[model samples]
Target chain A: MGKVVLVTGAARELGVRFVRRVQREPDVDRVVAVDAVEPVRGLGAASFVRADIRQPSIGTVLAEHAVDTVVHLDAQGAGPEGRAAGRAFAKEINVIGAMQLLGACQKAPAVRRLVIKSTTGVYGSAPRDPTVFDEQTVPGALPASGFAKDAVEVEGYVRGFARRRPDVAVTVLRFAQILGPARESPLAACFAQPVLPTALGHDPRLQFVHDDDAVEALRLAAGEPRAGTVKAGTFNIAGAGVLLLSQCARRLGLLTVPVPLPALRWGGGVLRRAGALELSAEQLRLLTHGRVVSTVRAREVLGFTPRRSTQETLAAFARERGAGPLPPGLLGGAVDRAAAVLAGARVRPPHRQEAERND
Target chain B: MTDAKVIPFGDDEGRPRAASTDRGARPRHRPSAGGRDPRRGGPPLSSVPEQRSEADALPPGRDAEQQGPGRQETGRQEPGQGGLLGRVLGDAWDARAARGLAFLRRRLTGEYEVDEFGYDEELTDQVLMSLLRPVYEKYFRVEVRGLEHIPSAGAALVVANHSGTLPLDGLMLQVAVHDHHPAQRRLRLLGADLVFSLPVVNEVARKAGHTLACAEDAQALLTRGEVVGVMPEGFKGLGKPFADRYRLQRFGRGGFVATALRTGAPIVPCSIVGAEEIYPMVGNSRTLARLFGLPYFPLTPTFPWLGALGAVPLPTKWTIQFGEPLATDAYAPEAAEDPMLMFQLTDQVRETIQHTLYKLLVRRRSVFF
Candidate 1:
């Protein structure tokens, strides 16, 4: 018999995309997408159920659907209105919502596999961090608060759930920043700005996974365990290679203003207060000391590799935003011309030919 | 020709007016004395004003006479370009200039690649190494020996004695390995957390292929067949007073040996002489160090007294000698976990470096020579 999959956080773009992908999987007999708010658009073949994971009533939806597989995708930082919707509300949806969802999943005996969407933010960016983090590397510094803390809490709850239900295969896919033309993430918003504010003297290595690859990874993890794939484990899902923040800005043809860490944080707070941007403390830490994780486990065990590299992913996002004031080709040409002129002036005497002719 | 030399023509206007006066004053004695001058063939006094007008109109032309040989040599090197336009373009579009422009274009377009550790090989090779080459060649006059001890391929750990109030020895060692080694392999140094926590130093360190001095990073690099350099006597040796020079500090719990054993990378003991006398740290101010969050505030004779000028290191002749490699592949993988084995290997490496330092110092004639 094919598997009955239940995906949470169906209203979000990533969630909706994941639901659409999973519903088409050969092994997925039915897909029940659950969310507090009704999706603005259609979910195709998948059925949409209006149920908040924060409440115990989510159990009824799971039991009614006989969900054999649960894909939790709602553990996100902020919402459509950004952090303007108060931290408490976001935390409630991310932490409490995951807790309640796990509770429901545990009671449903039909559920044999659980896949949770996690962020690499759990690794916490710090100066002392390892150059590249694998699955087993401990976070150098645990995040004090913010979405990273929430991710930590949610992962802890998932671990507890896994221990309680040893029969169920729990897969936690820790993904790097997800960027795509259709997605609207905090990083995307940051890139959308004309002037990107970066931490002075820091060009942290950043990694990104295309949204299509992210959905594909989720689909792979949610499906039934195949011969070459591990059924359940923690895996880092990110595109190969890394891009420096300055390089990203250059690629996007955006001007970068290097702000001191303290002033940048203060400015970020002001921007957040003014509802102009969403620069959380976690994001500031990320900007200061970029985080990169090894996706080897995801490739080796989970049987997933991102189709696009970090550079390619950024290019796609940049293409979607249209050309910036200084396209890379134009900038490169300008630099070449300036260098040629400087070189010419430095080597050749200006009036040498005229003096030789006169003589 | 004598007038050309006397007038201070050709790009002099581009310089400050005071510099032009200084140049004109120096050449005045030659013409007034009526001495036998080199290149004395010149036009009569009647043509002097016309020549001056020509020089004034085409200032850049004046340099061609002075740099005539160099311009001809450059033209001969680029044989295809014979016309005026080609000559002008050829002067600027030499092979070196072309290569440099290409590198700049690649950087501006973000086309170059950096490894997962943020190591940009192209930038390190072309830019960083060239910038350090002058100091490595002239300032330090480093003499490298026993380079054959380093493996031509595969992983090898180079444990060097750390001294010098600043960490210039590490950079010099890096240059020595790259310039002197037959394979021209790059040395990936593992630095302390402090090296990565600072602002400008952090970026340069990462780009120059230095990672955090952690066991995990070391193992990762070693397993990738990279030649990794480590200074086990970190701050303790670097900040030690001149009295303690050449005395290797405690090799930080033998962590490097453990990592080598884990990765089965041979440990090549490196002893560096002359670094100890560069700054001659006389004292360490603990109070000031704590106030500034520094590990140790060095009190050298010139520092703080001479201000920024004091930061300049004394030109001391340097000798970096690599000792025989200690093979760790013979040991079982479990040997890394054994503290006794780790201690024994660490002590052996430390003794080798200390003994080599004494040998180099005994053979040395003077520190500044």
Candidate 2:
């Protein structure tokens, strides 16, 4: 018999999209979509169950559906909007909701597989951090507080649940910064700005996974182990290669103004107060040091490789946003012309040759 | 030599004039050329006088018309200018200018690629190396020896002595490897975490292909077949007083050896002379160092008293010698874990560097020669 899958955070766009994709999966007999509020659009063949996972009522929804697979994606603070809802509310939905959901999963005997969507932020950015983080690499500095902390706590509860239910195949996918045409992540919001403010003296290496790849990775984790795929384990899900923040800014045709670290923090507060892009402490650290994770395990064991590389993912996102004020081609042409003019002038003077010969 | 090849062209252009002016400028450049000792085997220095005479022979107004864009295509009125020599020179100059412009365009458009570690190979080669080349060539007059010991390709660990209060030696060593080696290999230096913690230094260090002196980064670079350089002495050797110059400090915990053993890359002990005399750290202030959060506040003879001018490193002749490689592949795979094996290997490497330093010191004629 095909398995009954329950996906949390169904009202959200990513959740709705994931629910639609999972409903079409050959092994998924039924998809029970759960969220605190009703989704705006139809979930296609999947059934939407409006039940908040923070309360014990989520247990009734799970038991009623006889969910054989649980994809817990309701952990908040994944996007800027979630963070804008206030820190406490996001934490309650993330930590408390995960705890309640995991508790319900532990009691459900039919749930043989559990997949939790995690963020790479758990591996906090620091000066001493390893160049690339694999699944086993410990974070250089554990995040004090932020969405990263929430994810850490949620993963802790998931670990507890896994230990309690050894029979269930638990998969935790730590996704890097997710970006796509439809996504609205903190990084995406930062990129959308015409003028990007970056931390001074930092051109951090960044890794990104396309939103479609993220959903695909979740699907692969939630489903049964296909041929050549590992049954269950934690995997870092990110596209291949990396991009510097400066390179990203150039690609997006955005003018980046470098602000000192302290002033950046102050400016972030001011911007947030004015209902602009909210730069959390986690994001500030990320902007400064950046984080990159290795997806070798995901490729080798989980049998999932992202379709787009980091550069390609960003390019696709830029394409969807249309042309910025300064298109890359125009900027490149202007630079090339300016450089040609300068070089022509330098090589023009015969006396310059005498000066060079003297050196 | 490159000088001999250029002389034929100079003779063709201004043979009579060169002979007349050669005598006058020849004596003036001799003293400067003699400053570099001939016993120190390096790139031939005889080219300096020949090139200087060639430049002196050229009439300053001869190429005035060549500056105009219209005159570039049309043959010069002079009989010698229309030959293959002039065409080749003009084409070469245009090509170089075009290449430079293309590089600028790539940098502006962010079209270049950096490795996962943020090492920008193009920038390091085209910009950073050229910037440091003058100091490496003219200022220090670095003479490199035993460069053949480095493999033409594949991974190798270079353990060198660290000195000079400001760490200019590391950069000079990088230049030495890049310019002198047969393979023209880039040295990826393993630096202290403090170098990475700072603001501007952090960005430049990464761009110049220096990573934190941690085992993970070293192993990764070695596995990728990069020539990794590490100064095990770190702050200890760099901050030592003038009295301790050339006395090798303790190699820290044999970590580099273990890393080499694990990766099975041969360890090449490099001894760099003249770096110790650059700043000549006479004393260190603990209070100032603590207040500034520095390892040591160095007090040199010319420093603190000279203010900003004190930062200029003394022009001391330098010689870098790469010793024979110590093979780690012969050892058992688990040998890296054995503390005894690591200690023996580390000691062997350290002694080799210290011994070579003494030898180079004895051979040196003078510090500022």
Worst 10 residues of 2 chain A by lDDT: A76-85
The candidate maximizing lDDT is 1
Off by more than 4 A, model 2: A78-84, A336-359, B1-91
Question: Candidate 1 - CAPRI tier?
Answer: acceptable
Chain B: TM-scores of all predictions: 0.77, 0.79
Error of 1 at B220 (Å): 0.5
Error of 2 at A359 (Å): 26
Alpha-carbon deviation at A229 in model 1, angstroms: 2.0
* Residue pairs that clash (backbone atoms under 3 angstroms), model 1: A349-B60, A350-B60, A351-B60, A351-B61, A352-B61
Go through the candidates in order and give each one's C-alpha lDDT. 0.80, 0.79
